[model samples]
Target chain A: MEPLLSILIGVLVAGAVYLMLARSLMRFLFGLILLSNAANLAIFVSGRMTAGAPPLVPDGMDVPPEVVANALPQALVLTAIVIGFGLFAFALILAVRAFRSLGTLNTDDMRVAEPKEKG
Target chain B: MSWYLSLPLILPFATAIICYLLRDRPSGAWVSVAGSALGLVAAIVLMALVLQNGVVAGQMGEWPAPFGITLVADLLSAVMVLITAITALAVAIYALSDVDARHGQLGYHALFQILIAGVTGAFLTGDLFNLYVWFEVMLIASFGLLVLHGGKEQIDGGVKYVALNLISTILFLTGIGLLYGQTGTLNFADLAVKVDAVENKALLTVIAMLFMVAFSVKAAAFPLFFWLPAAYHTPSFAVSAVFAGLLTKVGVYALMRTFTLVFDHDVGYTHTILLWVACFTMVTGVLGAAAQSDFRKILSFHIISQIGYMILGLAIYTPLAIVGAVFYLVHHIIVKANLFLIAGISQRLTGGSDVFKIGGLYKSSPFLAVLFLIPAFSLAGFPPLSGFWAKYIIVKASLDESLWIVAFIALAVGLMTIYSMTKIWAEAFWKDHPDGIDPKLSALPGRTALLVPVIGLALLTMVIGLMPEPFVTFAERSAAQLLDPTEYITTVLGPEAMQAADPLEVAP
Candidate 1:
């Protein structure tokens, strides 16, 4: 299970890097989404997937019983996912705005901020 | 139990929410100013506490360290928070006159406040995961502020900034994950102890490199600083000023904290790489600045260069060198932000920011030119200025370590910085306006709000320069604290926890 998850993360990262290198802003957005998922999975796999009960306290005790799942990585991942969602949403909107205002998505052509001039 | 640590974090957030609620009204910007003032007061109190107590730690929700979120302020963190608050107040005041009604109505003040909150949070957080969260908070708010006005140049700059920063975020998260997997702890103090016990020394170095790359991108170090010059010149002057002052320094701060406190196990490899990065960053950044003809673009490039000096201090990894880094951090924030603010005023006075297009400021507005000269010369490392002392200490430290090549680059960069400053002076202030217009300061509206902060910050640069004794002593003490993390660990994780740790894992 761990090896399979590792392979999945590796593939996702490869795909993300490829898309991110493309000139189009839309492709870059796709790359970001894929990369974020890869990060999430990497964190999940690092915690060591074990077959055990859910990370819940049996009602009436202060701490969970022994042999439960590792809860810290899950909380970290959930937070990362939510924050990543917000950032991607903002990035997508920025891409759309760039398209509308700058009239091109090509990274090379988006030179309005940095106009080339002969010295 | 120390509430002072929480005040810096809470005040900005409170300002952010209140400013957002009142975004549509004219009073929103005023609310931001008031909130920043209060935040500055809180930071001063926190700094006083840390100066007296040496190290202060507080755990949230009553959970002990290693289990709950920890807020720790050593001398480094305290001074950083204090500097953040100072820049926030300066930028907040400048925003009143610079941020027009249209931008203000679009929640500019709210986003600015939130960015401050994020920066303060980053400085105060002791947990690794919490630091990542603070980076996100700062990133989101800066993205909003960068594109708020929505011009073609702004959107173009914003896209690149967002894309590159997202990649850095992912890399940082990945590093966090791998480090946790190796050590099974996310607390900084615990990681310092546990990382030593890991049998795989090679793997630890690899993880350390991963963190270095992630943070270098944030610090705008060499080969990773393309996103900064691309975007920084496009935002409003106030936005650019705060971004110039605080954002990249957050990256540099993270590098200093982690490298000194946690990643000291393999300093030979890690610090060597940092030293090379620091040299190239200095050379490349200055060269980048010399090529630019615009006002803000040149300043933006110089930010990359100044960052190199700070990193060089860290790379040297000696007590005096770390003191130089600490001193450089505080001094650069003031001078760089003041330079940007001065650029905004010059733009308002002349109707353009391109040096070729506007001129005659020496005759028309000598006051503004004097203000510009103070920061510009200080940035170029003139005697009796803040930058001079910062450069002197770092170069002296390098010479002490027998790093002749590094010392030469440090001095040579100072000379080149002076050259760049002269180019700006000759074209922007001395030469006659190509269009034959006299750019006068009186023409700028709300001149008090704009001029006050510039004057105030310029005065600060002078004070830090003239009275270098106290500041240098503070930097020395901070450097000593950084070199020996015993006080930090004991404060955060308790005295018994330090005793229970393995001796081999303790920092040398």
Candidate 2:
């Protein structure tokens, strides 16, 4: 389980990094999505490859039993997933707007927005 | 009374809902101002409340920390929010007549309020991932506002801004993910308790770098700051004012919070990187400012340069340095916003912010000149003004750290900053214009100018610089908050880490 999780994280990292280096804004968005997924997986796997832990204290005790699939990671991952979705949506919309206006999704095409008065 | 914890989040969200419902109606402009004014008042009251009560926090949706979202308000958060609210209010009033009519001022107002709400949210949120959410909320609204009057330049600028920010968000998300994976917690307080419990410090170092990259991008630090100068001047003065005032500081604040609290001493590699980056950022930003011919553009570059100060303080990692950074952030926010306002007014008179094109402004409008001079000298770190105290604290802190090289760099930066301010003065106020050029009222805005608040902000800057004991005390307490995250973690997780963090708390 640990080895399989590591492989998945590696693949996720590769795909996200590749997307990140792309020239197009859409690709950039995809890159971000890929990166976030990779992170979420890393977070998930970092909890030691748990098969199942509902995160609730078993038998509803005050101090959660030491053996619950580490509810903390799951909670963190949940928050991360929601935030990732928001970021993805925002980026997606921004990409659409840029393409619509700039007539190209290529990052290389976007330039000259600086203070022209400054050299 | 404890529920006032939610007002900062609730108010702007309510305003956002109203904004979407109203769309582009001019009345929406009125709504935005009313909402921000209320927020400003709430924020001030909150500040007063904190002053009286020390710190106040409450869990959201009635969930205890560790299991639910939390909002914590201490001196640091309150001060940042107060500055943000005041700037938002000033800009809201400024937008009425000064803005483009096509958006009816309301559309811009809507985004402006959301941006404020998001910034306030970022500062107040006790959870790390929730901070990411507020950042996105801000990014989307800022994107909308940046293009509210999309000309060729604005479209171009917005593209870069949106692109880089999206990348940063991804980086931030990934960092959160990695952090959660390693510690099995996302709540900052919860994570604080457990992250240090990790057996492998190297993996923790990697996670820390991830968060640093994310925040640095937002803060406009050296390599990551490339997007800022290129895009800052694209929007109108009122828009630029709030953007300049509150946005980047959110990143700086996050850096201060995360490094001091969550990462603690696990930031070895990152600290070296930050120190070098801070110096380079200052030098390059000042150079960028020196080379600029436009007023706003110069200020924009200086934003990067001055950000180095905040980063430098944090990198050095001292209590006094932290105080300096806090002081610098407040001073820079007020001065930067007002400088943008002055640029807007200058253009209103001259149709340009370019020094070469517009001249003899000293004779045209003495009030404008006076307005420009306050922030100008203040920014240049002139004595007896708010800007001086900020620079003094930072330089002194660096010297005490026995960081002679850094202290020298800071002094050089100060001199360079003065040179840039004087250049603007010479070009706009001292030089002569063409024979046929007629100087006019620069459209003295209106009831919307809200001159009282502008004066209040300026006076506040002065008071902060002069009678600064309260602010310094607050800043020190705030800085200490980072040293002892037991309160923060406990505040969020509801004593989950209280007994556990006892030893950790005592050591700091």
Query: How far in Å is the alpha carbon of B127 misplaced in model 1?
Result: 0.9
Best by lDDT: 1
Question: Which 10 successive residues of model 2 chain B have the least lDDT summed?
Answer: B499-508
Relative to the true structure, how large is the alpha-carbon lDDT of every model? Answer: 0.92, 0.78
Error of 1 at A51 (Å): 1.1
Clashes per model (N, Cα, C within 3 A): 0, 6
Model 1 chain B lDDT-worst window of ten:
B499-508
Root-mean-square deviation of every model? 2.4, 3.8
Report the CAPRI category for model 2: acceptable
Fnat of the models, one by one? 0.67, 0.61
For candidate 2, the per-residue lDDT at B415 reads: 94
Could you give me the TM-score of model 1 versus the true structure? 0.98
Per-residue lDDT for B397-443 in model 2, tens only? 88998999998998899899999999988888777655435555554
Model 1, residue A74: distance off in Å is: 0.2
